[model samples]
Target chain A: ELQKQFKQQEEHAGSLQASMNTTQEEITQLRHKHTMVKAAIQEAKWKQANLTRRVLKLVSAQEIERKRGVPLDQTEEQ
Target chain B: LMRQAAHVNAWDQLLQQGHDQVQQLRLTLNNVKTDQSRLQAELDFIQGQQQELEQLIEPLEAAAASTTPAQHQG
Candidate 1:
């Protein structure tokens, strides 16, 4: 009877340890996913910033072109 | 028997804790997706606005170019 009880306890302990290991793995996966998501967000933000800068530059170039009364390409036919 | 029961309870508690963390992670991921989509929409809007402004500038530029030589001559 005592031996049976010891065996049952050992089995329970082993199963619990397995579950803990699985949970740890899940946690690690979640952390990795979060890191990837953060990196993507940062990349999107950088792209948006670059687009905004380009738009501003284009606007400024158009203004300068207007003041000079020149065509956008500024290569007149000879 | 009692020790086995105690281990089962501890295992249950740990599983519940893990479930809660997963739920929180899901919520955070959802929020991040929402923010990313919103920013993307805003970027699209700004791009469209820039195109329209450039289009409007074209006619004005043409008008300015057409009159420039005449104004210089006068």
Candidate 2:
């Protein structure tokens, strides 16, 4: 009876170890994916910053040109 | 016989601990995945905004480039 109980427990331990291995692997993959997502977010923020700066400069230049009363064709030739 | 029972009990305890660890790890993984999805959504939003801003800037850039030299001449 004791041997039987021991064998059952050994089997239980083996299964538990197997499940732990699988869970650890899943966690590792999740962490890697999280890192990639963070990097992408950083990249998107950088692009947004650059685009905003360019838009501001362009808008200001357009305003100055409007105030100067520059003719469209003359400006185009320039 | 008693020693064998003790050994089995120890194994049971270890297995229970292992199960708890697996459960905790699974919860952490789920949270990480959720965060990953949220960040992805944020990235998409920022990229979309950036695209719209770029489109708005294109015509302005063209008009500015054309006007700069005329401003200089005047």
Candidate 3:
């Protein structure tokens, strides 16, 4: 009876160890995915900043042309 | 009998540690998944904003390009 108990305990430990290994591997993959998502976010933010700058420049140019007495319709027609 | 008890205690300890590690790893995975989704949402927002900004700029750019050559010629 003692031997059987010991064998069962050992099997339980083995199963737990296997579960831990699988969980650790999953964590590693999750970390990789997190890193990749973070990088993509960074790239998206950079693109957003560039587009914002372009929009500002264009808006400011239009403002300056308006101030210089250029008709908006004339510019649009050309 | 004492030796067998000691062996059982050791196995129990090992099993408990494994369970704890697995639990902790699962929590970490959940947090990472949440973060991934949040970042994805933010990226999507920025891309949407970029599209809007580009749309706003398109006509301005065309107008600027159209005017510049006329100004130069005049």
Candidate 4:
């Protein structure tokens, strides 16, 4: 009887190990995916910054001209 | 009979240790699950932010394209 119970316990341990392995696999995949998403976010933010810089260049130039006595309405290029 | 009793007691102790091992494994699993949940939420939030950032950039890109040739900023 004791031997049978020990055998059962061994089987239970095996089952639990399998489950733990599966969960570990899922965690690995999720971490991999999270890394990719973070990289993509970084790329997007960099693009946004570059675009903002380009647009600001034109606006700041016009501002400098207006401060040097050019009228705002006249600064509008047709 | 005495030897059988001793053997049985030994097996019982081993079985109890097995149960304890199982309990520890389960707790570790629960912790992994919690970690998974937190990571998933973080991923979802960052993805949402990425979408919002992309949307905000669209008009800026259009304006930039129309402004002039890409000027290299020093």
Q: Among these predicted structures, which one has the highest TM-score?
A: 2
TM-scores of the candidates in the order shown: 0.46, 0.79, 0.77, 0.52
True contacts recovered per prediction? 0.00, 0.94, 0.86, 0.00
Off by over 4 Å in 4: A1-78, B70-74
Interface RMSD list for the candidates: 6.8, 1.5, 1.6, 5.5
> What value of lDDT does candidate 3 attain over all alpha carbons?
0.79
Q: Which candidate number would show the highest lDDT if scored against the true structure?
A: 2
User: Which DockQ value does candidate 2 get?
Assistant: 0.62
lDDT of 1 by residue, A1-78 (tens): 556645765675676557667656765766676676666657666766765675576567557657765552366533
Q: For candidate 1, lDDT tens digit of each residue in B1-74?
A: 77876776676576567657656765766676576667656666765765676676667657656765665675
- Candidate 2 residue A36 Cα shift, in angstroms, is 1.9
The TM-score-based order of candidates, best leading, equals 2, 3, 4, 1
**lDDT score, candidate 2, position A68:** 65
When only the first chain is scored, the TM-scores of the models are 0.61, 0.79, 0.82, 0.72
lDDT of 4 by residue, B1-74 (tens): 99878977886786687677667656766765676686567667656766665666666567567544634431
| TM-score, A chain, model 2 | 0.79
**Which residue pairs overlap in candidate 1's backbone?**
none
In angstroms, the error of model 4 at A48 is 12
Q: Rank the candidates by lDDT, best first.
A: 2, 3, 4, 1
lDDT of 2 at B66: 83
lDDT agreement with native, every candidate:
0.63, 0.80, 0.79, 0.66
